[model samples]
Target: MAGLPSAITVYEVGPRDGLQNEAEPVPTAVKAELVRRLLAAGLPVVEATSFVHPRWVPQLADAGELLDTLAGDLGDAARDLPVLVPNERGLDRALERGCRHVAVFGSATETFAQRNLNRSWDQQFAMFAPVVERALAAGADVRAYVSMCFGDPWEGDVDPDRVVETGQRLLAMGATQLSLGDTIGVGTAGQVGDLVRRFVAAGTPVDRLALHFHDTYGQALANVLAGLLAGVTTYDASAGGLGGCPYAESATGNLATEDLLWFCRGLGIDTGVDLDAVVAASAWLADARGRPSPSAVVRALTG
Candidate 1:
């Protein structure tokens, strides 16, 4: 009920993480335009690209050009343009193109890590060791992702200790923030609060921790409130609620940005974002993808 930010910083990941796992690739122009639309809503952080290899995630290979060519107001409003970097090579390409921030992910479940990264969790951390050092030395802000913190479909329930351990390791390796991802969307409010509680008890800074959830069963917003009460403010959300994990078949779209914004308004927490603009943007992206958005708020607004 306390320790919440007066104004929460919502990181719009629709351009990058939300669209990456789609069965089809979107044009670079469409992606670039989405970035612009997000800024019209005045979101401070927009993760616009993923620097992964083309062979692995061909959807995001245009990352370099997107960063170079994206024009309009987004150029000025986006506080952190974080890109996903799987390794040092990925980091190199991102920095070369004026990327100010980058993110590296490690799963708490070993099996999921092996499937997603083809490496153990520890090795994934090791792969990022030099990447973190290089990024920090280059004056880039680094964010570390601890995925499947609540539970993994493949590995079942994850230990809270392991999640905290990975969070601590990434922070120790110079990551400025940690995003705990519920990759399968199976986390409930109690579980979310417990994980946040344990992470804080483990000496993790509450402000530096973020909650990334999916709404497979429509629990994302409820879980967000639970996190807010637990003193976690930062969140990762996708416009129009478009996303899913290719590695995990049952996964669904991420927590919808509009849905979260609606909740923030009801809670009297300022998000400093324009809801109508976000709905317009989400509608545009949904049309571009040729699918119905997972967001109830966007659906109703655009209906």
Candidate 2:
């Protein structure tokens, strides 16, 4: 606690990242309810849904419908919910529904760019430039995501330089914040610290960066500790540890919000999220999904 920030931003990705990998369709109503519950639970930022093509991610096919539902119920607050948009088309759909906060997903490795985005590493930026330009032109706050920052299944041991270079381009393109993702959950605490420092040394502000880590190798929380020591103040987490990459088979669930909250509480850092409320919400979602949550904290609290 001596070196760590007194508070950090918990960017909840439950409704979007968490539910995007579900085998079954989560009702639009259910997704909307999850967003409301997370916001009510004091998560500062809850990503509502993705505007990616339904053909690709059928789980989030109801992106527009879900936003509309939340718009009707949450009013202006719905407009502030962040959504992931992969391209101009996705951004159009989101803008049509009044989404003022949007995120663009990118890759730090060429293999993942080609496989997941259907573009080469260089070509992916071309695809994202207009999307970021348009989003910023429309007065939307844009967050850029550079995935596979630590390791990639196809291309092993991604260099931290590649991640920093990718993030530099995104920031230069007007993205206010960049989130470096351990897409395969293979990053260790040392890797986390070095990467954040790399970005900083490259002239990127630590405050303008966030870490999105998967728990596949059970190292997500440890990496978070490294991040805190390195001066990052924003973290991306999913409720109940409910997401994995549909494109990357090796990828697993994200850092669970409950797990993160428990860790931060133990460190005496403020996340402003209610642990009891989050556990209850995740428990309710696990019941809806007809399975137990994968989060250790959720299991310990609910079991």
Candidate 3:
């Protein structure tokens, strides 16, 4: 713990990234309540919803409605609700609904980019440039997600240099932060350290980068330790481990918020998140979804 930061920021993504892939449609109210509970659990940044076309992710079709309901409820917390915008149309919808923070997603590999966005790597940057510019012009904070940063389902072992280049471009395009994603959950602790080192060496500030990992390989916490050793503080996690890649069949949930909190707490790293509250929220969500939470911490605590 000597080298690790004493405090870190946990960006909760359960409502948006977690439930989007669920086969069952969670009601808009439930999704809104999930956001509320996550905020109540002391998560500083809770991703509220995505403005992507409903056809692609019908689960979050009520993005606008959810935002409208939480408009007055969020009060001072409204600024922490970051929504996902896949394109110009999504950005427009978000802005119309008074979204002040948004996230754009890109891929480190061309195969996943084409499959996920129907565009090549360079084309995806072109697509995000205007989105970032418009959001910045509207006085909104922008975060960029680079998927498949470690390994790709179609193209294994993505080049770290490519990931660094994408991160640099995203930062140059006005993204206030960059989230490096292990879309397929194939990353190792050593790989994470190496990736962070490469990004920092490429001129990316460590504070401007966050890590998003899936626990498919049971290495999420170990990778987090590596990131901590490398001085990366911000991380993205979902409650109850409630998500998986719809494209990569083997990819499991994002690193669970409860689990991550427990790990950080053990390491004396302050996340400012209530572990029990997050477990309770995940339990409520699990019951609503008619399944046990995939998170080990939730199961142990709730049981």
Which lDDT tens digits does candidate 3 get at residues 66-184? 88888868775565589999999999998887788999989989998898898999999999999999999999999999999999878888999999998899999999999999987
Angstrom error of the Cα, residue 180, model 2: value is 0.5
lDDT tens digits by residue: candidate 1, 67-148: 7667343463333578999888999887776667899988898998898899998888888899999999988889999889
Q: In model 2, which runs have C-alpha deviations exceeding 4 angstroms?
A: none
Best by TM-score: 2
Pairs that collide in candidate 1 are none
User: TM-scores, in order shown?
Assistant: 0.96, 0.99, 0.98
RMSD of each: 1.7, 0.7, 1.0
Tens digits of per-residue lDDT for model 2 on 153-247? 99899989989999999999999999999999999999999999888999998999999999998999999999999999999999999999999
The weakest ten consecutive residues by lDDT in model 2 span 27-36
lDDT of each: 0.87, 0.94, 0.91
